[model samples]
Target: MSGTGGRTLLTVRGLAKRFGGLVAVDDVDFDLDDGEILGIIGPNGAGKTTTFNLIAGALRADAGSIRLRDAEIAGLPAHKVAARGILRTFQHNRPFKGMNVLENLLVGAHRRVRARPWAAALGLPSARREDAALAAAARETLAFVGLGDHAASDVSKLSFGQGRLLECARALMGEPAIILFDEPAAGLTSVEAERLGGVIRGIAARGIAVLLIEHDMRFLLPLAHRVVVLDRGAKIADGTPAAISREPAVIEAYLGRHAGAAA
Candidate 1:
């Protein structure tokens, strides 16, 4: 279900990306509202990932405007975009190799740290206080994602599902205005995916926008407030899950003959 009475948080207009002669994202435009779950779905080579990369600032858009609260963020570097309150998770888990779960989460909060380098290096009281506060927040975030018990566990010791949850917790450490999830349900058992879906719903309930790209309709359709369907690098449909399910273009281009069964 869509969040009601929320303001628009992110806007993309005329967004386009090209690789040599291939148009990866063709003049795409979409709006993400605060506390909303917006899903992007398409078949392979449909430019979903490319669109995600552009929004996350991992890739520059060839032509378009990306606005975060009215500020143009189209060509900002990934770190800058992150600092501006846009964070993302990968399709695969990317835990910090040597860090424990809590420590890995702390790393995600680096952009939020306000202490000067010298202050931290000298162990000044302000830096120490900030460190303590951030650590506390990290713990809170881990608990939010159902990973509280694993705070001290080595990242390598985590199961695949736990690692994915860790990634979500880490992203939360940044206090993002929007979190971009790339194929979040991939490689998870049904139970794990169901749990992750609940966590995502909680995230939106807290007023953070969620942008999701996933191939798993069973996992995404019921979770998203709205969905954008892409075909051949262009959006073919954009609406509520039920509405999208009935879109003729979407069915023909991406869902195929068994669209009804899939829906």
Candidate 2:
């Protein structure tokens, strides 16, 4: 279903993946709309990360169709998929160790750089102008993710939660049509998770599609416009947060019997 007034931006059908004899993902299908936050939730080994990897081109799908609008992106390499405007953040922060926060963010904008290597090597006017512009945009993204003050700080100086926000800002610098988040709230404290939730909402408000795979139900349910539940690598429920909370199968499989009351 479309979110608010947004149109469909991503479509997945019969998506399947296997690791030897184990089925990691089994014929999953879903649609993501522009400006929507779609959460994929499941217990351990339920194919959440595998599905995420397939969509982001981090892993090849053994069978299925993954389309960004009308173009097939299922088998594309990671860089090619990123070039097509899909960016992602990992469960663990992976910032550039030697770079300052802003410099790290600038790396994410590499796809948008227009100057030729020769021009940049020679420090030509065009290259200088492009560098300045990208740097400015990177700063804006840093501020947007609440890391404005850390722009000049060493990446190692930031706390774990701050590092996660940095990962988010770096992805935003790519100006992605869709952003895949793998367990974003995994290592965050309650307050940190809440803050991150607000940042995610802000991202969706800008018309970027958000596909999140999170194990934290409390964080996922309230923030997602729609939730897709998986059990044993198969989708068992798909609906609004409220509806998902009350699903018998979902409750039994993952959410537990108290899910309705908790939600």
Candidate 3:
């Protein structure tokens, strides 16, 4: 997809990875444009998740350049990468199950705490100020997902759809400019999907870029400004949803699963 005024938000160049004898990702080159809803569509085992892993620092790339805002960040450690504001949600909604939804969101704001050791230990004025800020932010995030009243609920007790929104909220707590969403619509009912779509648009309205990797074209086409198709770890097409939806090569590669995969 074309970036915001030709500005590249993320650049992946010559990215290649191998696991034992399997070439999971093969010299893939792509870029995510600024503030665009870019959908990544692919079949099972097309290295979609692996690409996310490498970008988020869950795995080290054997070869490539990962540049965020034009600075090289390929080999950085996970925490360092996160500190750089590139955040991601898991394909699975991996919440901190033992904690309440509010607590989970608070954890995402750890990087923002400004407290001295003694002040925090004694619950001083500084600690109170920071805590108040976090509490307000957490509530706002929950409200964005239509769960402000359930902030105290245990994440383990949330319904499947609520849990997914909570997962997204926890990531949003970081206030990141870019977030990678792995199948945000998976397992959601029509109503839930509609809500999720609104949430995604809200995120974009805040000028945050979303790179969505989803299997449901029905859910994606309506929201995505552009789409990218992958097959066996290679990009076959990158264009607007209407154009990509009509490509025969994309249809053949993604067959029988995505909405137009069988076209």
Candidate 4:
């Protein structure tokens, strides 16, 4: 198996979803190659978020299969899915306001999916060791995402761009093989977005796959290795950025989809 049949790190086959009489997502199939930066785009209400929700286990799929590195993961709980090396960020870069930035990141490092709660609560020696390891990893992850200076800062204190970086840092703390990013560059300034683009390339350099759902084609174009276009829950195009931008079907899909969305 090669080309479409081989080297895929993630796969969605026969993917579908339903809400009463509405089909939010309908039988979509796609593959994300290993370490690839896959950019996904669609107009408003095109089921892009629905697809992310389904793959991230935020919602149950009516029918289909989601595979990470060839392992089936459909119907699994969100945390369990994350344990299988899949981490996801939402369109809104919501950070826990109760915890400082570092503390919030440390929480994400507990990726084993099983730990002695009481031990952790009481700060047992084993738990202390785990905390230390996570704290160090969190620092490294923060620096990797260009938030090292803000490590001791509060989450409620971050700028929009900084918050997005923190979200990526938190996801990296889990040591995920792949991360699903939803509108990561949304609400960012031009300079901030460019910095984030550089950071994403660094992430790919670290050998983690990134599958992003973005509406800003101008920003996504330079970063994405491949682009996938969705229309009314179905994939309308899949190819390089140049090819995708030239596809008439894709242009039509975005015409009435999102007025302010850049192309």
Alpha carbon deviation, residue 122, candidate 3 (Å): 3.0
TM-score of each: 0.95, 0.95, 0.91, 0.88
Error of 3 at 62 (Å): 1.7
Q: CA lDDT, every prediction?
A: 0.90, 0.90, 0.84, 0.83
Q: Which stretches of candidate 2 lie over 4 Å from their true place?
A: 257-263
Off by over 4 Å in 4: 1-6, 112-127, 255-263
lDDT score, residue 140, model 1? 93
Worst 10 residues of 1 by lDDT: 254-263
User: Given candidate 2, what's the lDDT at residue 85?
Assistant: 90
Rank list by TM-score: 2, 1, 3, 4
- Report how far residue 248 has shifted in candidate 3, in Å: 1.5
**CA-only RMSD, every prediction:** 2.1, 2.2, 2.2, 2.9
Query: 162, model 3: CA deviation in Å?
Result: 0.4
* Model 1: residue 217 alpha-carbon error in angstroms: 0.8
Q: Please give, for residues 73-108, the per-residue lDDT of candidate 1 as tens digits.
A: 999999899999899998888887998999998887
lDDT of 2 by residue, 72-163 (tens): 99999989999999999988899889989998888768877989999999999999999999998998999999999999999999999999
Candidate that scores best on TM-score? 2
Candidate 2 all-Cα RMSD: 2.2
Tens digit of per-residue lDDT, candidate 4, span 17-134: 9988988898988888766888889887788889999988999999999988768999999989988888987678878778888988876667742448898899788878877777
